[model samples]
Target: MDIFSRPQTERSPLIDFDFANRRLRIEGESYPEDAASFFGPMFKSLEGFLADVSDETRSAPISVDLRLSYFNSSSAKALMNLFQMLEETARGGVPVEICWNYEADDETMQEFGEDFGEDMEYARFNLRVLDTDVS
Candidate 1:
């Protein structure tokens, strides 16, 4: 499948989903006017990609990197949903690694990362502190 990408806007994050390489990255602020509308396509594409994973493909690892400077409550919900999908995929024998990168001095973001990482049952979750600011 072709790569799915969206450049970051003033109120949204950058989304790059490379299905063929099994790498997904989301960075920047995420507070789009309509959270559902902004994330709907991503959800659809991810669902399609997850559904297409086969026995032969399960050996390849899926890497997800999320570096968000800020996000609203709605965006947080969307992220939780995304994590749930990845967790499910990992539970089904696929190797899924998620790295939540946050600024070293940003306690809120660090806590948020911890909160998100706490629910993972199968996927590997890493909390990385960025040396510099993301914004």
Candidate 2:
């Protein structure tokens, strides 16, 4: 699953989805004018990657790392569905872990992570706050 490797866009995040290593990362902002238009292919790619993974590997785990500074309400809903799919996969015996990363001062993102974590019963969800002073 090859994902965003170009210059950042205003409407889409940097999709670094990798199936071979089972590491998917979405960073930056998400406020696409057409939420479905953006998420449609993204979700399709995810499904395809997962399918290929299921066919080849039996016990490899997937790790999702999300670091978004902002997202529209529609995008938020889309993200929820994405998490649901991941949770379902995990329940199907494939280990999955989600790391929701946000800026240290962003409470909205933290709450969003908490909500998704609460909804997931099989996948392990973690909320990570990036420190601005790390540099």
Candidate 3:
């Protein structure tokens, strides 16, 4: 599977899907005019990559990092779908890790991640508070 990387914009997040490394990261703010339109291809590519995970690949844990500055309700729903896919994949015996990164002061985003993590039953979810001070 090829790597999928997309540049971030005012309305969308930066997407980095390293299929070979079994790591995927999505960052930045997301309030796209059309959430589905922006995420449709992403979902397709991720589904394909996850579905291709074999027993050999299962040994190395697959990880997903989501660092969202902010996101609308639609984007949140899309994220839930993504998490659900990961949960299902993990349930199928794949070692999976989901890290939700948020700015230290962003209470809303932190709570959002916690809520999302609560919904995930199969995959392990970690809340990582990002360093807000940039030196």
Candidate 4:
């Protein structure tokens, strides 16, 4: 599949999904007025990518990086949905790695990352500390 990218906006995050390379990155704040509208395309793309996974494509691990400064409850739910999808794929034998990046001084974000990481059953989930604040 082709790469899917959306530039960050004041009320949204940057989404860079390089399906060909099996790497996806999301960064910046997320408090879009309509969370579903903002994340729907990404969810569709990810679903499509998962549906197309083959033995050849499964050889490489899918990397997911999330770096968010702040997000509303709706965005949090969307993220949970995203994680569930990736976790399901990993449970199916596909290699999936998720890294939640948070600023070192941001304890709340760190705790949030830890909370998210705890839900992984098959996918490798990691909490990464950012040296500098991205807020």
Candidate 5:
């Protein structure tokens, strides 16, 4: 099942939730008009997927990569929820990895990644700031 390609909006982040092969990614800037409203469904969908995990689950050893340049505080909360869901899934025997990628110059994003990483246990979250040409 494919849960990628979020609806285009005036202020929304791009999403790529691939259920096949156990890799999920959310990249690009995120400053949605309504953070909670936009992220609620996303959290719900992720939870639903994890709830039905069995022997034949497509998403095992899940890897979620987040490369956001800017996200409001509300979005940060929503992100925490997402991490929580993934952490729970990992604790249930399924290994999980969250890669938080940020621009090398952006210390804010690096710190944000560290914050999220500190909160997780089962999931091996990585805080990697890369030098990219976003210009």
Candidate 6:
């Protein structure tokens, strides 16, 4: 289970996908020109990681923290796909929690999280407001 850590860029976010800890944290903005290219490997790694989780450790809760300052429509769609996969994985018996962290002053981010949360009926979805001054 290799950790996937990518530094943040002007048009993307910082991705820290830790399979060993069963935790993934994606921070910063996501507005890449090619969303699929940006997220393909992440999605593939997650799928493999989910499949590799042994029965003995399946009980360990999986957590994903999404802390985004901003994202464009393409990135939003990619996010929806990621959320769907997580929700499916959770529905298949693994315990999962997804925290959508948004800046406290960003109503748009809050609404986006809520919209995404609606699709995650099985996974424990949380819309967390972080007290960040970043606009």
The lDDT of model 2 is 0.83
Q: Would you give me the overall lDDT of model 3? A: 0.92
TM-score of 4: 0.96
Alpha-carbon local distance difference test for all models: 0.96, 0.83, 0.92, 0.94, 0.80, 0.90
Model 6: per-residue lDDT, tens digit, 1-135? 579888999999999998888899999999998999999989889889988878898789999999999999988888988888889888988899999998778999999989899888789999998875657
Lowest summed-lDDT stretch of 10 residues in model 3?
A: 51-60
Candidate structures ordered by TM-score, highest first: 1, 4, 3, 6, 2, 5
lDDT of 2 at 126: 89
Cand. 5 Cα-lDDT: 0.80
**TM-scores for every candidate against the unseen true structure:** 0.96, 0.90, 0.95, 0.96, 0.88, 0.94
Q: Let me know the TM-score candidate 2 reaches against the reference structure.
A: 0.90
lDDT of 3 by residue, 17-90 (tens): 99998899999999999999899999999989887877778778888999998999999999999999999998
Return the lDDT, model 1, position 29. Answer: 98
Q: After superposition, how far is residue 67 of candidate 5 from its true place, in Å?
A: 0.5
Maximum-TM-score candidate: 1
State how far residue 62 of model 2 sits from its true place (Å): 0.3
lDDT of 1: 0.96
* Per-residue lDDT of model 4, residues 9-128, tens digit only: 999999999998899999999999999999999999999999999988776899999999999999999999999999999999999999999988899999999999899999999998
Off by over 4 Å in 3: none
Across 1-135, the per-residue lDDT of candidate 2 in tens digits comes to: 455332349877887777668888888899888989878877888888777665457588899999888888998999999998998899888999999998878899888888878998999998888878956
Error of 5 at 113 (Å): 0.5
Which ten-residue region of model 6 has the weakest summed lDDT? 126-135
